[model samples]
Target: MSTRSHSAVMLRRNFKHVARNPTSVFNAVLMPIVMMVMFVYMLGDAFSVGVDYVDYATPGLMLMAVCYGLGAVATAVNSDLTKGIINRFKVMDVSRGAVLTGHVVASVLTNLIAIAALVAVAFLLGFSPSAGLFDWLGVVGLVVLLGLAAGWFTVALGLAAKSPETAGLASVPLVMLPFFSSAIVPAEKMGPGLREFAEYQPFTPVIETLRGLLAGAPSAGDAIAAVAWCVGIALVGYLWARAKFSKRA
Candidate 1:
């Protein structure tokens, strides 16, 4: 079979698998909503910086939605690995890039849905953006890119994990970083030591960049730093995942 044909076949198969699984779709949207409510209500008042707590939080929550979608990708990949699907595909005329891309696309699509729902909730909770349509699109684009970058790492984690449960359990740090970073609270409010650390963390740049974009303000150098971090993580993760996939196959 041609390489394009093989890729198309793999993507179709994966999409069908996801579509048939109601639980997967439900959790993708549900988890982000729960987290947003918990943070906005419980921590909103206590977590003030200069910005509106929820507005500052919306970007972080959006990132967290991406993070969770990637974690689900980890679960799906590990499940496939455990079920011998990877080996089955390896023996066939399969394109590894297609296989990876298919999963990544599914992950990005899922994150987009979750983000939309989260944004709706944010809007109902008095969250408003000064951003224009283009700016809104840019924020969406950034979230999608964030999902893709994080998906690479989760894919690697999936390949490395002993089981699906283990893969899910291993993603705690990715979920936790935004809370400590400038996502929920201002860097200045954190301890001087932690504040310094959060200032330079990967997610901080991402959050800051998106925050500025959504606020209709100019972004600082952090935007470049965010792109660098995402691209760097994606490259490293893809290399590691490919190596691991080769070994497992």
Candidate 2:
């Protein structure tokens, strides 16, 4: 079958799967909302860094949305593996890209809803984007790319996991990287050595880049760092996931 035809079929099948499981939808939207509310209210005072903490936090909340979106890839992959659905796909004449396109596209769309909800919540709490429409589009584009790269890594994790619990536990590190970087606080607040490390951490640059875009500031260094991290993660994740998928197949 043609790749497009295959992708359409797979997309339909996956959408059906999601539709049948309404609880997954609830969790996808609920989990991110909970995190956004929890951190913006509880941790805002503890990590005051000279800005409206919510404004500073909007990017971080967006990142969390991306992270949660990526988890859908992991969860779907895990569900397929647990039920031998992947092996069934292997027996079909489906194009390889079909599986990926369906899962990733559905995931991105679902997450966009959560993103809109989160943005609305942020606005309700006094967070406003200083960025113009084009710049805001750029932010969304960058976020989708970042989420795509991260999604592959999570796919690999789900493929390699021994159980659903292991897959769930594995997401912790993925979500924590942003918190440890300059996402919440200014990196300067850390010890000198830690500050330096935070400056160099992958998420720090991405967060900084997004911050500049959202704040209506143009920052070349931040843009370069964000692109670098996205590309690097995509390369590593593709390599790892390809290797694991080959072995599993």
Candidate 3:
């Protein structure tokens, strides 16, 4: 079979895995909603600074949702690795890259759905921002890129893990990354050391870009930086995962 056909078959299998195990999807959607609610109701008035906290926070929550979805990818990949599924595939005539590609594609699609659910809940909670059609499109594109980057990175982690538990633990730092970024609060408000780290970290520029796009205040620099970070992460992760897979296989 062609590489594309191999990938398509694996993709279908991954989707069925998702269907059989729905908690990953549920948790991906739930974490952001719970965070949004807690932040908006519990701290919105204090943190909003005269603007709508929901609007100010929703972009960050969306990004966090993407991060949360990575945990699922890691878990799924690790399960397959540990359960000998990958080993079985190695004996078959499957395209070498198709297995990982299938997981990445399915994880990206799942993340998009989680993002939509987060946005819907945000709107219901009074999160509103002004953005043109093109802006929205840009936001979606940016989000997909971010998801791809993060998903691949998690796939690498999953492949490297000896067990599913280790894979889940490995992704904890990714979930916590946005908290240290400009996602939850402005980096300027942080201490000097932390501010520097938060400003320069991978998640910061992406969060800022999303915020800018959704608020109708797009920044060319931030957009460029976000895309650069996503591409860089994706390339590194793809190479790392490919090498790891080959070595193991």
Candidate 4:
């Protein structure tokens, strides 16, 4: 069979594994919802961004949801590796790229589901967005790019880990970075040192770009920076994962 055909098989296998795990589903879907509720109700009125706090916070919440949803990619890849399934696949002549492709695609699909659910709940909670058709398309495109970048990066981490437990923690930093970004608070509001970090971090451009898109005023500079960062991350992740897979598996 062709590599694409093999990838499809692997994809189905990975998808089934994730679907059978309730924890994975909760992390991808419900975690975001819970965070959204907590942030909106607990601190919504405390902030005074130019827009409503709910609207101000949605972009950040979506980003956290994406980060949380993708943690399983590393776990799944590590599970196959630690269980010797990768060696079995090798003996069976499975394409290496196909195996990795399966994990990456499955991860992205999980995040897509999580994003959809988050957006729906956001609407119910009065999260108003001003994006037009093109803006919405841009948002989806940017998010998918991020997922691809994160998916491949996590796959590399998974391949490098000695166990699935370590791999499962690979995405924790990503999940936490939004808090230090402009997602929940403006960079200007932060202390001098932290404000600098907040302004320069990758997630800042991402959240800024997304927020601008949703607000109907996408900044050319932030959008360019966000896309550049995503492309760079994806490229780096692809090379690293391929090298690690070749070396180890």
Give lDDT tens digits, candidate 1, residues 1-249: 776677677667766676677776666777888888888867689764776777878988888787765566788888888898877887875777777777777777778888999999999877988998887877877787788788888888888999999988777688777777887777888898899989988899998888888898838687788888999988888898888877775
Which candidate gets the maximum TM-score versus the true structure?
4
lDDT of 4: 0.88
- TM-score: which is higher, 1 or 4? 4
Query: Compared with the true structure, what per-residue lDDT tens digits does model 4 show for residues 104-143?
Result: 9988888888888888988988988999999999999989
C-alpha positional error of residue 90 in candidate 2 after TM-score superposition, expressed in Å: 2.4
Report the number of backbone clashes for model 2. Answer: 0
Q: Ten-residue segment with the worst summed lDDT in candidate 3? A: 41-50
Cα lDDT of model 3 by residue, 1-249, tens digit: 899999999999987787677687666767778888898868888884447888888889999989887777888898888898888887887887999999999888888887888889888889888989999999999999998899889999999988898998999999999999987788998998999999999999999899999999999999999999999999998998998888876
Per-residue lDDT of candidate 2, residues 27-125 (tens digit):
566677787778787777787678888888888777777776555567777777777777788798666567766776666666677778988888887
Clashes of each: 0, 0, 0, 0
By TM-score, rank the candidates, best first: 4, 3, 1, 2
Model 4, which residues run further than 4 Å from truth?
Answer: none
TM-score of 2: 0.88
User: Which segments of model 1 are wrong by more than 4 Å?
Assistant: 1-5, 15-23
Winner on TM-score between 1 and 2 is 1
User: Which regions of candidate 2 fall more than 4 Å away from where they truly are?
Assistant: 15-23
**Better lDDT candidate (2, 3):** 3
- Computed on alpha carbons, the lDDT of every model, listed in order, comes to 0.80, 0.76, 0.88, 0.88
